[model samples]
Target: MRSARRQYLLESALMTNPLHTFQAWLDDAKRHGVHEPTAMALGTVDEHNHPSVRMVLLKHADEQGFVFYTNTESPKAMDLDHCPFASLCFYWNPPGRQVRVNGRVELVSIEEADAYFNSRPYLSRIGARASRQSQPLDGYAELERAVASEMLRYPRGHVPRPKNWTGYRVIPQMIELWKERPFRLHERLQYTRTGNHWTEQELFP
Candidate 1:
């Protein structure tokens, strides 16, 4: 492909507000009932330099970055504690679009977590308290019993948020948006944050 042609395609994407463009796609995905459209693969590294990735729901996203809830005592949390950098990739296969973000990890404000927790179902809140995430479980019956016990303990269904379960926000430094095209070519646009400004660039596929 001619460099000029490629650059034109890239310019088309860049000239349009990247944030708004991508957000529009996300909203469309949600409206189309894309299964778990907010879910992304979260990647983190441990102290020993081993990398781990898992599908986590993207609970929040904006100029500040992305946020997701998890057990603070889980393996992922341990890894985050040691290495506060992470990456997130969202793939909307049906729409043939993808977004990748690299960012530093930070614990979301208590207020945010509390509000989200309160929005959860009563039974879900109880289950969050009963399950010690990432920990070995004896059996399904044991888990059910634990949940039942916790439910009884909070008969009013006003379960408090678990101290060990909270939210983490990723402060993005770089974000990439990819779109599928014909002839084995793909469109890639990236936005990088440096200090107070954002820089946009195009990558060849």
Candidate 2:
């Protein structure tokens, strides 16, 4: 009965815009108490053509692209630099819904990156410059010392975004939404980009 109602609502209330629908689903997930709703699995290919996946926090999403920040020198960032194509998968437990995006990656602008970086907490800003992501460290104490050292360089309210830290935008070519139903049946809606517009396809679960 719950599945039937959900299916009914999905069909009746489906938005024409995939990005809008994605934002709506995210809002719904937050209302449903899904922790860290913005967390997503980012998939990329390294220079050697090996596939890699990591969890990244989604900063923003719009018709333009889905955005996330990271150290530009990290392994994942290096992978993206070698190959611009990538994918993002987002799953919400309560609603049992998943969103998958496949597209080419591009770097966000310096001004834009600076604005978002400035919005983060001071400690987080310090951490970005303190630690070398994916690099070896002596120990937790070493990391703590590095953080402390970084903190002193830029007092409380004024930490500049590190040069190695910036944002990336995934220019989605295809977006798919999966809605789970009882008995293992699911509904999938896919949107493919066609120039400036989108073409929709319904897939069998």
Candidate 3:
């Protein structure tokens, strides 16, 4: 039974585009009760080539690639401005599956950012306006005061999207998927994009 299951998974991995396959796995993770199923570790490099990584939520994903939103003035955003290349990694322990994506990053359109910003919860929008992301704050009280100030400014109506808050899309050049197995012998599949098509291959465990 274990052999049959492994074979099935391998076949499935080769049968679809990596983005679609990743979405399927993400859905399974959600169904299996994995917390923060959309969370991914984002890796980026600064102008000096220093690498930094942090966990970010995967807000969108499709044929174009993965998308996430953040403050344009944040450290990660600064790194992206200097070096647009990035990598994203998703691991779902409950399903023993992982996905890795490497690509170039680009800012989403202003219209896209506006739409998403409007959809955010009211308090979240206010918080985005209040925080000066990646900048050193005097203290917790300072942050609280900023939030309070933003609340007063917005009052009861729509909170406009901050100019520095926006979204980015990672246009993937390569994607890799891995499934765990006994004794550390794992199944690995990789897809590399060329022009409009993707070439798929299996890697040694």
Over 79-147, each residue of candidate 3 has an lDDT whose tens digit, in order, gives 999999999999999889999999999999999999999999999999999999989999999999999
Q: Which residue pairs clash in candidate 2?
A: none
Pairs with backbone N, CA or C atoms under 3 Å apart (clashes), candidate 1 = none
Off by over 4 Å in 1: 1-17
Note each model's CA RMSD in angstroms.
2.8, 3.2, 2.8
Task: Give the alpha carbon lDDT tens digit for every residue of 1-205 in model 2.
Answer: 2345335536666576788889989998999999999999999999899999999999989988999999999999999999999999999989899999999999999999999999998899999999899999898999999999998888788898899999999999999988888897788888999877878777788
Score candidate 1 by TM-score against the native: 0.91
Candidate 1, lDDT over the whole model: 0.85
Error of 3 at 103 (Å): 0.3
Off by over 4 Å in 3: 1-7, 10-14
